[model samples]
Target: MQYFTICAMEDTDLSSDSDLDALINCTLLYAATKFKRKKRIWKSSYLRKRETHGEFRLTSEFSDDQFTNYFRMNRMQFEEVHNTIQNKIYHEGSRAHKEITTKEKLAVFLRYLASGNSYKSIGYSYRLGDRTVSKIVNEVSAAIWECLQQTFLPDPTEELWKQIAKEFEQRWQFPHCVGSIDGKHIVVKKPAKSGSSYFNYKHTCSIVLMATVDANYKFITVDIGSMGRFSDGNIFSSSILYKKIQNKTLKLPEPDMISGGEKELPYVFVGDEAFPLLENLMRPYPKRKVTANYENKVFNYRLSRARQTVECAFGILAGRFHVFRKPFEIKLASVDNVVKAACVLHNYLRMTSTATNVEDIADEELLSDQLTSIRYNNSRNSRNAFLVRENYTHYFNTTGAVQWQRDSILRGKY
Candidate 1:
């Protein structure tokens, strides 16, 4: 070996400046090529091992309970969603390599939503890059919102509204009520260049989720991505739902006769004092200096009871998908998609889950009242709205009264 090396160096003419330079360049190029090959080998081996043993693999290995606990969904539900959005999420493999399966992408998205894990942490567990994880999560969440909106949260027809009103009456003992309306602050990271627009009274950066829920704790309609600094009344006034109601374009059912009286009333949504009282919307009487009469008290209690459904819906939403419990460290648009997806998933789960009692999942802490003061609208029909409220107050005290309503009012147990 020594003789061959000496002979090769003698033949290569190491004495010339140009030859030496060529030799050095060639040697450096050879070394770089060798290093790159070794790096490729190591990365391929690591990825193969990770694919074989990482948490993504465990998803298939897990038992039913483990699967449910990890993904916050059953196999059937996962398959249903996967099938609906398979075309959207599917990526055709190229000659370079096989694309990640749609199933894997969905699994990553669900795991992120269920665990609320950071992108880096989730990517590590799933053997993906953080950017890939983020891309998959956002894509899958947007697909969920688009694919499930019609089936899970379609606008209600007149008949459906009446059905909702009937459910409210039967389940909550509230007459002529269709749904409960409320708003929640979805905490988020401070947005770039957003000043105090997203800063809420709670001192946290957030977006508002204004939703109307039916008696079964299902979201009938939702208006999300409102500025957190806006009041609930302001948010509602700007919502599409409110606009439809205002223009009488929602095709609400005709007035129905009160159960025990000849007076007919339009179906109305029940809200708290943070909302303005309208002919089609009822809020509790102000709890300030004005003493609420017995009839007003009963009406308030009944409205509160009905309004509890929307609160409980939010509770169940946060409890099941705990991502809402923490501040989402993402862009504002991404947060909106995440929230919309969560809302649709909440409705889907509620429709399919076997748990009959809402108390099992409802987070009462989220339902606590946030009403600050009575918000009065400056509409021309303001006095007429008050008279409408008074009429309902009278009806609750007399014809539409319930046996236990009086006792509930007396005990101050709304």
Candidate 2:
């Protein structure tokens, strides 16, 4: 009708039936094309009301235990983390479409992290666009790292290192032990055009997250985003942590004696069989197929105890932030930020939640830091490392020995 009205207003000649038919067909086609696309709308209404939903209710109406289950942290701890990153994540505007508040952004990001839900799924729950969900996660992750890294996961200081060593001695009974260092393969989808670099022995593509954690299950240092194909030992050896130790760049304290034991030893990080036994890094002695020596058994048992800190740390991370259980959506550049964010959050929770379960583990599987120095000569260092292990072994068996270590639990599985 409009096309005809325009023709009539211009007094255009349309006497021919064929021409009139052609004009009508063209107009109908144009109209169909114009209306075919869905109309754009503002304000996601009728999807879900986050205000009346868990985002608000979880804070006020729900119990702290329920809140912890959903966000992976109690309300108090969550509030502390939110407060630190709130300014950075705050969206300032007065657009017709409501802006996601800092709290909502954090809630969205934490929901994604705490549940490992797809962006679309989380978006549906929060009435957000999938892209918005992704953006919020990335943004919050960066903010968490930027705002909390120094206080929560800062580089080890001399005095802080001493304090950590003291805690280990008192808690885990490993004197001069500063932290436990270990690495786990974080599974990720194979990257584009890259062949075999990320492939690992388990027939999966992954990146390694290496961390050093103190006795109280707090991460002291972290190194992440290493290629997974490399063996754990090789990865550690080539790491900046290893390089610093080799070059003597870490401000490791001078050699000192244990409080209740003899033989002066340097501060060390305990690791599993994947790491070499260094003067400042202790590893268990190799298991024997035949009858094992009594001293080696006792030494391995004690080292295993110190090493459990890293194991439990990883377990708690996987248990709480379940994203670690499955293969991560393959993202290289942003993976470090995400992993680092999770680790920092772990520290935050450990620092704030006094009665929290530090021993939590992921069901069935998904198991998966501190420093040691180096010697220039491989042979000499090997000799020195053996002597150091022997020193700790003798110390544990005699003066430093605890009553519980005498139990039958000293038996090594391997």
Per-candidate alpha-carbon RMSD to the true structure: 3.8, 5.3
* lDDT: worst 10-residue window of model 1: 369-378
lDDT of 2 by residue, 1-414 (tens): 566646743654578777677677767766876776757666556543655653444556667777888888877777888888999988875555666788888888787778887778887777677887788888999999999999999888899989998999888888888899888888887999879998877778878888898998889888888887885467888788888888887778888888777879888889876787787888777656215577677787788888888877877787778777667783676678888999998898878777746436433134631111111112224788888888888998898877887674544432
| Superposed model 1: Cα runs more than 4 Å off | 1-46, 95-97, 288-292, 357-362, 366-381
C-alpha lDDT values of all predictions: 0.79, 0.77
Q: Tell me the lDDT of model 1 at 185.
A: 79
Clash tally, candidates in order: 0, 4
lDDT of 1 by residue, 1-414 (tens): 334444556678888888777666666766776676773332354445556776878878889977887888889988999999998888886654547789989998888888788899888888877888889988999999999999999989999899899999899988778899888777788988999998777777778888899999899998888887875467778889889988998878887787786577888999886777788998888765225577667778888999988877887777666677678898788888888998898888878877654443545565433211113333333776787788888887787788898778768765
Candidate closest to the true structure, highest TM-score: 1
User: Which ten residues in a row are the worst by lDDT in model 2?
Assistant: 369-378
Highest-lDDT candidate: 1
- Candidate 2 C-alpha error for residue 251, in Å: 1.4
